[model samples]
Target: AKLRGENGCPWDRKQTAQTLVKYIRNETEELIAAIENKDKENICEELGDVLYLICMITAINEEQGNFTFPQVVQGINEKLIRRHPHVFAGTRYKDEEELARQWEAIKAEEKREHRQAAEKREP
Candidate 1:
């Protein structure tokens, strides 16, 4: 909050979600490089950078009344749990191919549900 406040850094204050896309890409690339090279320290640093960019983008949207950081966190948590029924819900998959198919099917069902909900919301 302070970073985007009236008294905060001008660069930070001026950033928008769109403007941060390049930084996100660069940070992700750096993170991939760190992982490939097995540089644990750089990997951690790059992870932090990527996480910071995500929070910054979330904060920007939050200020615009679009969504909050907690909503994003909750969304991913729900998605992970929903997608991994084998681990969380005692569902069984025989092999990698079966798991991949199940994952896609779950995603398709979620998309269908979302579309239905959106249709219901529309006038």
Candidate 2:
């Protein structure tokens, strides 16, 4: 609340979800540069910067009462569990080829479900 309050930094308060694109792109480039340099230290530092931007953006959404960080994390964690059949769903895999097949199958199912849900929406 304080961060988004009037007393907060004007730059931060004025930021919208759409405005973060350049920031995300810049952080992504920085991370890529660190990786290309083969500098483990810079890689770690730049990764933190990228993650910080993500968190900040999440906070922006939360201030608007759109979604919270825990909700986003939970959704992704559940999706990971849903997607990895061989790891958690007691599905058998023979090799990397079979693993890839399972992953794609799970992904396609998720996509179909999402599409169906979207189709049902008014918008």
Candidate 3:
């Protein structure tokens, strides 16, 4: 979203979410094709294009004061830590079933709280 700010590039400021949709999709398709063709050069170029578009849109979002890209990254980092408590919290899992159960229990509780918050916001 930094690129879409008032102080960002003029080209980014001109773009809307509607405008960049097909461009990103096309770049992803090209990358997939390059991967199937085993062309490292083409894949690299296409991946760069896709990443650029992602950054551009994120810059726009940040400018709107919704949330910054760092927030997005940090949220994911926190989620990884939460999900892997065996590593970060000294918790141990005896089996995959236990791990799955723990993950689902946490996710369901989080969702229930989120739903309650949303319901509270309703008139």
CA-lDDT, candidates in order: 0.97, 0.87, 0.85
Weakest 10 consecutive residues, lDDT, candidate 3?
Answer: 1-10
Could you give candidate 3's per-residue lDDT for residues 6-117 as a string of tens digits? 6978877899767999998899999999999999999999989998887777776776787788998898898888777888999999999999999998788778888999
Candidate 1 structure quality by residue, lDDT tens digits, 31-113: 99999999999999999999999999999999999999989999999999999999999999899999999999999999999
Q: How well is each residue in 32-120 modelled by candidate 2, as lDDT tens digits?
A: 99999998999999999888778888998898898999999999999999888677878888899988887898899889999999999
For model 1, what is the error of residue 8's alpha carbon versus the real structure, in angstroms, after optimal superposition?
0.3
Best by lDDT: 1
TM-score of each model, paired residue for residue: 0.90, 0.89, 0.65
Off by over 4 Å in 2: none
Residue pairs with clashing backbones, model 2? none
| Model with the higher TM-score, candidate 1 or 3 | 1
Clashes per prediction? 0, 0, 4
Q: What is the full ranking by TM-score, best candidate first? A: 1, 2, 3
TM-score of 1: 0.90
Stretches of candidate 1 exceeding 4 Å from the true structure: 114-123
